[model samples]
Target: MTTYHFVGIKGTGMSPLAQILHDMNYNVQGSDIKQHIFTQQALEERNIAISSFDKENIKADQVIIAGNAFPDEHKEIVRAKELGLPIYRYHHFLGEFVKKFTSVAVTGSHGKTSTTGLLAHVLEAANPTSYLIGDGSGKGMENSEYFVFEACEYRRHFLSYEPSYAIMTNVDFDHPDYFKDVNDVFDAFQSMALQVQKGIIACGDDPYLHQMQAKVPMLFYGMNDNNDFQAGNIQVSPEGTTFDVFVRNSFYETFSIPGFGKHNVLNALAVIALCHYEQVEVSIIQQQLKSFKGVKRRFSEKVVGRQVLIDDYAHHPTEIKATIESAKQKYPDKEVVAIFQPHTFTRTQTFLNEFADSLSQADAVYLCDIFGSARENAGDLRIENLQERIQNSHIISEDTIDCLTGHGNSVLLFMGAGDIQKYQKAYESQLAS
Candidate 1:
């Protein structure tokens, strides 16, 4: 058997792919800087060994898979190239690995993780299904007829995939580091839609995507008259959201999901549409979606005393707005307190006013330190810069978790794509003490 060594193995996608490969009885081992990340727990549980990045770890016969977060100058990757070992980019490897199975790629600016998780859960109920989700969830089956994976459109990386079935949740201007404008973002999705081998299920409500005419049979789903699958009469309760799905202007079935927001209702509709196309029984899909607890950190909730704390991986303006809207919908009576950590310098500078506008929807807002990635850093951009644009937004540091200690009966939401969990842990520790 060939050995596979992943160079930055504990990434959200890399960890899950490592787990999937390991479960398939492959000889797998890897390394990462974030060795103590929550995703690391999964690797340790499977007895997968990890070392700090080292040139010595690159053996002669092993395949090296590099994580996207790391650059070509990464120690192991550079050493592997010099040693004549076969190297693969993260997305390149995934594109190849998913082709053997009937692949379902879920792509969008937001909701890809949640929709992918829901679809994987629902499909697993009827047929053996394998999935790789951005939430660091992955599983392998000895006999899986289908593979469901989250396809991100950032940096136009998702173009590497040609899925058996592709689901476009919605398209919007994002990844300001790469794309120039909203039109640039739309062109990428249009390209993705054309790459699908089987069919495409897209959100019809996205005004930009509605105009794209494709060669594939595109089934539209949303609360719109033009959609082939429409979610109507939506109701959001404490239990979840319930809506009737219509196919071709006729009532098909009523579906309920244990999730909040109109965005989630549309996500459920996308899953329902795919299930119907795949010929899976509707009852099985309905029960699975309703029972799905949720993907990790996508509005994950915990309670301490009278305070409800929610942690979500919402970095962009659209995502932050959706997460807060969902929180308000689920816990209507509680005050929604938002603690946001801006992800990257480029993203923050690009969407400063947009971020300020979306964050203002919260009952109260707290801004944490900007989390800089390995990529670019535009000059002099700071959290205080974004904080100045919003009303009643306080600058918070991890050192003063006690400031949030007595948020009596408030819904404290920690939102970001970066290390915002540090703030959540600080708050929880303060409460514990």
Candidate 2:
């Protein structure tokens, strides 16, 4: 059996891909700093060995899979080069791996994870389906006919994938570390659009995506009447969301998903559109959407005392706005509090005003120190500067947890793309104490 070793295996994408390869019967193992990441549990559950990232970990016969977050200078990466063993970048390996099955690559600036998850759930109900989600989740079926995966636009990494069918969730300016502007982001998506081998399912609501040109047959889905697939009579409640799906001026199906926002409703709509195209049973898709429990950290909820704590991976301004709006729909009577940890200096600077505007939607706002990228320097930009723009927002730490403590009715939302969980853990421990 060929062995695969992943460098920086704890990374979100790397870990899931590792699991996918392992389930494919490849002798898969990896190395990372012994951090207690959520991905670690998945690795442990699969019996994938995790070791320290050392030169010693690199073996002559093992193929090395390098995490994008890690540079070529990483010890194991260097060792792999010295040994001249075959190595593949995460996306390169992933792109090649999924080609064996009928693949659906869900790509966009936002909602890819949730959309992929929903699509996977639907496909699994209709037939065996394999999927890799951004939330560090992956499953490979013994004989899955369909493969559903989240395709990211960061660094144009998704360009490596030429999926049979591609779902464009909506393109927006994000990953300040890479793309220069919204147009630059759109250019990347357009490139990906041209690479789709079969068909394209795109969101009509996004202005940027509307500008794209694709060679494949494009099916547009959104709330707009002009789209090929439209969502109508949408209803949002604490329990979930329901909407009627219209295709080519006819009511195709009435669907409901146990997720809170219009964004989620849109995500469900995309899945339904794809299922219709695939001729998946509408009843099976509806049942799967209704029974979906959701992925980790995409508005995941935990109740402590009477207060509900929601954990979300909403780092960008648009995403934060969606999460807050979803919270409002779910708990209209409760005070919503947002605890945001800005992910990167470049991103924070790029969307500073938008971030302030989104957080202001909440009843209370708290900011943690900006989570700097290992590649970035701590510039003059500070979270306090963001607080200046956001009235009633305060910089918070474990030392100041008492200031916001004892809120039994407030919905505490922990939001970011970084290690914001540290702050959540501290606050939860304080509340427990």
Candidate 3:
């Protein structure tokens, strides 16, 4: 058996691939910077050895899978080249591996992780399924018949895949650091849509997505009658959301999921459409959809005293709005407090007002300093600029996180893609004291 080495095993996408290979009974080990990330917990549970970065970690009898974050100049890459061992970029390796089974690529600017998790759960009930979810979740069956994975559109990375089917959640302007504007982002998804081998299941509500022109057959799903797969008669209560599916304006089934927000409904609808197309039993689809426990760091919740602390990866303005809406839907009686840390300086600078407007939807708001990258290290943007836009918004640090304790019976949304969890951790420690 050949050993598989992941250059950056703790990454959201890389970690899951490592887990999938590990579950398949492959010899797997990886090297990273030694900082503890949430993804490492799953790797640790499997006893996958992870060590600090060293060129010596690479051996003669290994196939190296490097995360896209690492470049040719990375020490491990240099060593892998010296040995003339096969080295595959993470996406390139996934693209090849997916060809072995009936593959479904879930891609979007937002909701990819949540939708991928939902689909994976539903599909596993219908067939022997393997999945790679963005929240660092993966499972492999030795005789798997279906492969479900999340494909990101950033830098056109999703174009690396040629899936039999795709679930396009939406196309919204994001990642200002890379693409020039929303049209640039649209062009990238449009290019990816052309690569689907069989069909595409896309959300029809998105103006950009509904207009997508692809060679493969497309089914549009949404909350309105305008879509090929539509969900209507929706109701939301504390328990969850209930909606009826209409296929070609005909009633198909009524499904209820223990998740709130129109985004969640649309996500479930996308999965339902794909499962329907695949001939999955409707009973199995409904059961697994409701039983999905959710992915890591995407609205992960814990209760302490009178407060509900939710850790979510809602870095974009659109995602922030959806998360806040979900919180409101689930806990209408409680105050929804948003503790937001802007992920990147460029993104904060790009969507400054948009972020402020979305965050203002919450009952109260708290802002954390921007988490920046070295590539676009210098920027005029500041978190105070965002704080200035919202009335009564507080600027907070991990040291002063105790201020959140004042919001009694509140739903605290710890939202961001960066190291925002540190603030949550600090606050949790405050509660313990």
Candidate 4:
């Protein structure tokens, strides 16, 4: 058997895919930068060979799967081409690989990762399930009955996948780098919806998704009675949130999740709807939702002294808004302090005002410098541009992280897609001192 080699193996999606293949007893190994990443722990636990990029890493017996972030000009990719080895882009390979099992593709502008993780956990109790979560989690079970994976809409890569069913949480304009506008993003999702072999489970509340046309049945789930699957009689407390599930205006059952926010309730609704259709018992779904530990860096929390520190991946404006709301719900007595690090120049420029409005929802706000990835160059915008829009928002750096301690037991939400953890790390070190 040919060994599967991954380029840029430490990436968010790439790490989990490598882990899944390794679990299946495949010869999995890869290369990346010498710098350490949190995702590398999973790969190393499996004893997968991970070395720094070099021409020697490529051999005639290897099958290369190039990460989306890397280009053909990279040394490893160049070496693979010279040797005439089989090469596959990450998305292309995943599209073909998922066909082997009963697949459910979780797609949307947001909530894909959380919803995907929820589905995998719930389904595993009912069937032998394999999953690829965006939070760097994946497992390949022997004789797996289903394959559930997170499918992203960046650059229309999700269209490459043809899953049996799809759960589109919502369709909002994100990834401003590639998509020109909301309509452009909708067009891509519309194309993806048509390709589903089975029915589609979608959030009916989204106006863009409501306008979508597809040959497959569009099953809607939301808080409103108009939806095929609805959540009503909601209750939220410090423990978590509970709501009644109404199937076509009649109560099916009541469920609780160990999480706050309406967005989370909707995520559970999508999972409940899909599993109900598949004949999974309501008791199993309820149990899994209640016990879900949640995905990494998504409202993940810990208590440090008096302050509540949370790490979340809320790069987009809408996601930032939801994160703040959840924080407020969980700790109504404390302040929600947002420490936001913008991911890319294009996204920051495109959603500058929108970002300001969302961050202003918090009791206090701190802004970090924009993180530029290898894919794009610096734009004309600066971090101060966003700071000026929000009244009294402080510009923070790793050196000034101590200022956060002054908030007096506030819920500090460290939100970003980039390396905002370093700021949290800096604060933790100061607290230790």
Global lDDT of each candidate: 0.90, 0.89, 0.93, 0.94
Estimate, for each residue in 38-113, the C-alpha lDDT of model 1 and write its tens digit.
Answer: 8888889999999987789998989999999888998898899998989999999999988999999999888999
lDDT of 4 at 368: 94
Query: Cα miss at 109, model 1 (Å)?
Result: 0.6
Q: Which stretches of candidate 3 lie over 4 Å from their true place?
A: none
Q: What TM-score, computed on C-alpha atoms, does each candidate reach?
A: 0.98, 0.98, 0.99, 0.99
Model 2, span 1-433: residue lDDT tens = 6689999888888888888878878798999887689987898999999998789988878999998888888888888999999999999998998888889999999999888888898898888888999899988876879999998898889989989999999888998888898899888999999999989999998888777798888898999988999999988766788888889889888888888888998888888888889999888988999999999889999988778988999999999999999988999888999999999999999888999999999999999999999999877998888999999788998678767665668789999998999888887888778
Model 4 poorest 10 in a row by lDDT: 372-381
lDDT ranking from best candidate downward = 4, 3, 1, 2
Q: In model 4, what lDDT does residue 13 have? A: 87
Reference-based lDDT, residue 92, model 2: 97
Tens-digit lDDT track for model 4 on 1-433? 8999999998888999999998888999999999989889999998889999998999999999999989999999999999999999999999999999999999999999999999999999999999999988889976898999999999899988999999999999888889999999999999999999988999999889889898988899998768999999999998999999999988899999999999999999999999999999999999999999999999999998779999999999999999999999999999899999999998998899999999999999999999977788776789999999999999999999999989997999999999999999999999999
True-structure RMSD, every candidate: 1.2, 1.1, 0.9, 0.8
Candidate 1: stretches off by over 4 Å: none
Q: Write the per-residue lDDT of candidate 3 for residues 351-418, one digit (tens) a residue.
A: 98999999999999999999888678845777889999999999999999999989999999999989
